[model samples]
Target: MTVTSSERTLLDSIDAQEIVSLTTSLIDAGGENPGDTEEATAKVLAEHCRALGFDVRTVEVAPGRPNVFVSIGSAERPGVLFVGHSDVVPAGTGWTTDPFSAVVRDGRIVGRGACDMKGGLAAVVAAMAAVHRAGLADEHPMTLACLVDEEDTGLGIRAFVAESEQRNYTCCVVAEPTDLVTIVGCRGAANIEVEVRGRSAHAGQPRNGANAISAAARIIGIIEGSQAELDANPDPDLGPATWNVGTIAGGTGTSMVADRCVLAVDRRLLPGESAAGVVGDLRSRIESAELTGSGIDVDITISMEMPGFLTSVNHGLVTTAVQSVIDARFIPNGRSAGSTPAPNGRFAGSTPAEFTDIWTASCDGGFVAQQMGIDTVVLGPGEIENQAHRPDESLAVQQLTDSARAYALIATRIAALPGL
Candidate 1:
């Protein structure tokens, strides 16, 4: 396939308002699973893909886990992959309107997945529509893949990368809530559970028994105490990796020194940090603690984890995204027709090529970048602060439009990919 300016123009000509509606509707509908908001979203995205006249396929990896894939060009062609999860995190409680109801207020769209993702999904649809409207389909091929299970676990992407043998592509764009910044890399995390064993005894003679809760507290001390070491050495982009003692459970009753204590930990990691290294170090820390006569026991198990990944800013995806953003925001050191101060339709820098980019923390980007060997760029609409997940989670109208434009341009540039 060849490239043409008319196709880019067509993609650029997409209606931003419609894109917002499309996204809002999906958010309002919500998905079924923790990641796949609704199975309908898969069908909706498939329709969008088909409407653009692309060859689309849906892979139901698990019982209800549905992943959609559409290729605009042949697999042999150099292409760009736009990857996003069709699923949205669950809407827990509290809301100005129904969490699934697309409420447009003060020019903003509000819903559960409004900012966390649906915003990006809608923009993807608009971008697809643009390629068709602009006739870009005739020149280049781009793959828009929407997967399920990015929220609960990255099973969808994990499955796609594992199940699909012919997935080699040039680069990838993930529509996460990064406020349209080009996020290159970020920290990974480990979700672990620790259990402490002990003997049971009556409160009157507690000294004769082992107190699991007490032993667990000592473990907490070791874990929390280790934070100083983690904080002291921070990654440039992701900053200092931190550990949080999230939950604790132990003992049978107040009157007895009952056995069994459990603690849930959330550990965030930076670049150069490995799970084995972190877990081993933590285990060593626990072992090194003197608990000879404490009458307590301990054990730990990994619950979940996502790895950290980075891409070079010099990579074609990174350079093109940054250049596109600079051109959209700063005066081209000059002026152009219809050029005025509007929302900067550009992505900030952090993803794609692992160069000098600053990603704030861990996300699904970790899975695509590290697990699947796909260079992931975190770029999307809305501020990271506002994805409040309740009490009216929202995405600014302008943010949606801007992100849609950025995705459109990035998709175009990616379709015209360079050697990976």
Candidate 2:
């Protein structure tokens, strides 16, 4: 596909400075998850959307946590949607600068959420502004959804899916930090809590009580034994379904035999796996263990689950996104002189190539793909492994500009398709 004059106009209208300013503002707003402080970020996003003359709506998914929606064009038609999260993980100790400072140095913006998603969020909002400014709002429909609680449980996305049941979105682009590579699939995740119970006894008479900690250790061993089997059958793109024992707590004091133990396990799932199925299989395995005869009782529960998604690489959305990334790289204004090359040696202004990969980390895009049945792809600025959730997290300014341009291109191309 070729870039049209109108598309060029839209791309040119996306100012790099504007995107940087917005990103800085968002970073300064400070939405740290587990703190329930996303309202500040939502307000910043909503203000920007209103300033751009888009119809803005804020829906409260939880107390002091809102999802901001910015829309343009007719609601009656199917549209291209941009999804992003507003929350950031807590800024742990060890930062050279204040995590909320949104500092710019060495041509990179530094902050807590700068790379993980605030930068991506700014790019999407800037793209929408450009699309609206270039008179494209009347040409097609576009929506930008800024959600909360992605860093923790997926409360915002779950609420979005429930409320958007009547809307017909043809495709979704989750502006996650993909280092600009098109992501075709991701692993799903679930949090399983196992509680083991037994009778407590004095330390002097430990054998008189069934040891809950010992039973819990046995269960942990059972979980570990399943890993090799999962590793043997890994998904070609998303990798194997794996298990991680995140937390374990048992026993009150050394003076008495432990009566209870709780184990929190994180399980990554493949496309066909469900939380219920995993829990059932685990429960069955544990029940068949020797704990039944030892007066040990076990209870398992699924605290949270996020489904995985796989979009065909050949889909129009994926193809368009790939082309958009290539096109964005070639734009003179979008190239950063000081930008670092990707791990594969690709850099801005280099010979353009099509790159696609899968995310081991999941996102809200899975919800859109599975529940709404919309074709979805993950593409945005910054490196997930190297930058996101790391101290002094930062994103290159060039990436911010390129991502905005690419998003605008995607919005126009996908909206102008024949059937939609």
Candidate 3:
């Protein structure tokens, strides 16, 4: 299938109504209950794959959660992966609708995961479909890796790479919502829990026992001081790393002298830094602190290790995607479409018209870039600010349709590259 400029325009002219219906259907896929939303989400995706004549399969990676993999191009050409997560961040408090219910109001698909990722997922599939309708699969290979559990953790993507080593792909395009920015790099994420212990003391007796809060005071100092080191090593484009004592618990209500304290530490790592090393540093800080003398103990454990991703601007994937975005948004390409900002205020203006910067957030692309060692970039539709884990997350109808067009253009060029 040869995709010419005419083919690009043809796919770009996707039915807005069809996109809204798909969005509503996808939003209704109530797989967010700690269960595999994959079944419902995959059902929608599988139908698209089948209609487009691609090989589709849902591999059960977990008990109820499954990872969906679809391939549209033949094995003869170089394989490129398009990874997207079907799961969304849990809907928070105060939603107007049943979070799962995709309501159409104000010209947007409103629901959980509509912006953070479900929107991206729908757009990617539509892009794939557009590629098929334009008959461009004959020249290039495109694979969609829709995994589960990206909202709670990135293990879904990790499991996919570990389980499926069957096909080797040279590039991965993760459809993470970046508004319109070209994200070439990301900061690593580290989740650590620190604990402290002390003998309970009566409120009336001042010297009877040690105060756990007092013991924790030293621990806090050590952790806070570590910020300098975090900042000492800076990450390009994204400034120096940072750490936060996000959560702290001690004392049983306000009436008693706390005997135990726990610290939940959040550390954002810069490039060239390892998640393990960051944990070790925090551990060393805890041990080196003066809390040990006061019967206070420190425990540091890494709950999550999300590695950062970055490829040179010159990488074929980056070069291609950035050019694709610029052409679609600014250059004389077929990307001059109009879209309104999400319900929340995360976007600037209604449509994309410039080379926006990458967002500071975690995405499955982080794992693919680090785990798969594939040149990756996070590009997609919808404004990100109002969409991520918000009470009201929604994507404009036009944004969904236009993002599909942009992605299709990129896929066509990728598949038709001289040698894969």
Candidate 4:
């Protein structure tokens, strides 16, 4: 698709420095999970959106947590929605600099949530502002949803979905770290807890007690064996479902036989799998095991579950997003927009390629796509593997600038389509 003069003007209006500055301020605001600081982040975002001549409001999801909504153009029509989370994981130890300082070193923004995903959030804000400033909002309406509690249990998105039952939206774009790729599908996730009970006795006479730890071990073995079965039937895009034994605890002391044991497991699901069904199947398997008549009791429960989503690769949103990235990479001056200068003064990692892939990790996008029946695509600025939740988390400055341009184009193209 060719870039029109109006779209070119809008893209050129995206200020790189402004995006970087806002990203730094957001990182410095410090909305860490397990902490009540998302309010601060929401304030910063609302203030900025208001300054851009847009309608901004904050809806409280909890006592202190709020989701910020920024609107451009009329609410009567179905618009493009940009979804993002304001909360970031807690910054653990082993950093050479302050985690909240928002340092810019070697063309990268170093901070706690720079990559996953304050940078992406800032880019979305910048894109919306640019579109509004270009006098295109009336034709290309847009909304920015800055959510909360995404790192923990997804309370903010749930609240938004509940209130949005009567609202109209064409599609959604979740601003998560995807290394600039368009993610068409993501794996769902669930946390399961298992408990085992047996008779307790002194270790001096092992045969006098039914060992609970031994019974738990048998369940763990079953879980490990199920992985092979899942691997045999993998999804074409999102891959196979798998199980992980995250944590396990049993026994009090070596002098006594254990009577109780607990295990925490993480399960990744395919698009059509349900957490309840998976749990039921596992319970049935455990009940039918040899331990059923061996004087042992077993219990299973699901602590959390997030659904997965799959969008067609041929969808207009996906193709538009890919083209937007390609267009954003080339400027009028024939120089790549997001090229980083190497130590020897040459460009390093300049050209941006189109990559349509799937995400193994779950996100708030699943909730929007599955619950609201909206087509959702995850695309953002940073690399999740090396940048998210690490000691010195950071993202490239050029990526932020390019992402803003790409998002602006996506909004314009999607809104202009007929029968959307």
**How high is each candidate's TM-score?**
0.86, 0.93, 0.86, 0.93
Clashing pairs in 4: none
Give the Å error, residue 100, model 3.
Answer: 2.6
Q: What is the C-alpha RMSD of each candidate to the true structure, in Å?
A: 4.2, 3.2, 4.5, 3.7
Model 3 pairs in collision: 1-138, 31-37, 140-415
Q: Which ranking of candidates, highest TM-score first?
A: 2, 4, 1, 3
lDDT of 2 by residue, 60-172 (tens): 99899999988987788888899999999999988999999899999999999999899999999888888888787767678888999999999999999988444568899
Model 1 global lDDT (CA atoms, 0 to 1): 0.71
Stretches > 4 Å off in candidate 2: 164-166, 331-354, 416-420
Model 2: pairs clashing at backbone N, Cα or C within 3 Å: none
lDDT of 4 by residue, 15-69 (tens): 9899999999999999999786799889998998898898998899998899999
Model 1 TM-score, all chains together = 0.86
Query: Each prediction's Cα lDDT score?
Result: 0.71, 0.86, 0.70, 0.85
* Better lDDT candidate (1, 3): 1
Q: Can you tell me which runs of candidate 4 are displaced by over 4 Å?
A: 164-166, 290-295, 331-354
The 10 consecutive residues of candidate 1 with the worst lDDT sum are: 346-355
Of 1 and 4, the candidate ahead on TM-score is 4
lDDT of 3: 0.70
